[model samples]
Target: MMRRLLVVACVLLPLPAFAHAILTSSKPAAGGSIAAGHQTLDFQYNSKIDHRRSRLTLTGPEGAPVVLTILPSSATNALDAEADLKPGAYTLRWQALALDGHITRGDVPFTVTAP
Candidate 1:
């Protein structure tokens, strides 16, 4: 019975964890472009996130990482911020913490064009 118990444990452990805060959608999508000026950044996840514990970092063409302040929102599974962007490339890095205690991170690369 030991072998059978081990097989059952392995099958159960292989299940996917739905607690992860997966990035479902985003504004200024990956490999996308936006108009240069004041832009609102938004990120959506599959699970409810703890906005207080999350972070948004903006890296512009100059290669400086600026930590953005999270805007308050009624949406529990999203993050929002604003920044003035110049005509160049940028990467928006997002680190989110799900209510279930899982943390997820990803980078959204895009460019800004002169309006």
Candidate 2:
């Protein structure tokens, strides 16, 4: 009986780990660069996220944090936004809440160059 219960617990414990939202990829990929001007940001996650509860914050070269608008998503596991960038360094901080009520956050630091 103990052996059977241990096996069940092990199986169920790993399931919750899969529900945490993890940033799998990004548009201006971390440490990458983009052209200065209107740009679209895309963030892909490993699990389905609650878009309504997620947030994206952008910090420009001047060190001011601006909250970017979260656009409607066609893909359930991705978040998208838009912003007008100037030539400088920038960091996009993302906070995502998974369907299972877990919150995950990450940063994508990139630079914008004059085009």
Candidate 3:
């Protein structure tokens, strides 16, 4: 019957809410500190992400947000970017789209100390 078929289809389909990527770990960690100047930012996720579609935004000491360039050689489930920071509070906001086509985002707030 149509009702039974509809129920089956719903059961078979994967839930979108559960397929979103989660930040498992990150370099310079959240609320963590690092030295000023050139640094590599890394973000590891719970699932494989589309590096080409993912984004990393850095908010520097001046309170302006800049879109970081994603490194080409980074791993599938990880995002890596390079940044030159100054001594002040900063935040790295990231957005990732997983293999399942779900997008997830979060922020990493940290401080840049004098080298």
Candidate 4:
């Protein structure tokens, strides 16, 4: 019975090699505040992103949408864009290719104070 239990546990346990995507960090830090009319918006990922399959967007306080594209280089996989944000709240929604080839996405909110 103990040997059978051990085999079952091993089968149920998470694999040593698994793949997933997560937001390690972000500028403005989700619900953080910053000056309005930001020259650039940034999103950082914990793992490498598949640029060809990634997408990002920034919505203004007025609900206007600004699309951000992928920027992959030797150093990092970052999504960025320039915006003339107005003083108010904004939303950032992002989707990307996980290391395991799955899609992962989430939304975050932030505020842009009037300069």
Best by lDDT: 3
Off by over 4 Å in 4: 1-18, 72-75
TM-scores for all candidates?
0.83, 0.84, 0.84, 0.73
lDDT tens digits, residue span 26-114, model 1: 88999999999998888998888899999999999999899999999627889999999999999999999876565779999999999
List candidate 1 stretches off by more than 4 Å: 1-18
- Estimate, for each residue in 1-115, the C-alpha lDDT of model 4 and write its tens digit: 8757644654576343324457777776798987876456677776677777788788876677777755454224566556667788888888877545556898879988989
1-114: candidate 3 lDDT, tens digit per residue: 875664455457756433568898999899999999999999998778899999999998898899999999889789999999999999999999886665789999999999
Question: Alpha carbon lDDT of residue 81, candidate 4?
Answer: 54
Please report, in order, the local distance difference test score of every candidate based on alpha carbons.
0.85, 0.87, 0.87, 0.70
The TM-score of predicted model 1 comes to 0.83
* lDDT measured at residue 65 in model 4 versus the true structure, 0 to 100: 75
Question: By the TM-score metric, which is better: model 1 or model 2?
Answer: 2
Question: Residue 4, candidate 4: how far off, in angstroms?
Answer: 27
Which candidate number has the best TM-score?
Answer: 2
Report how far residue 25 has shifted in candidate 3, in Å.
0.6
Clashing pairs in 3: none
On a 0 to 100 scale, what is the lDDT of residue 84 in model 1?
Answer: 96
Q: Candidate 4 overall Cα lDDT vs. reference?
A: 0.70
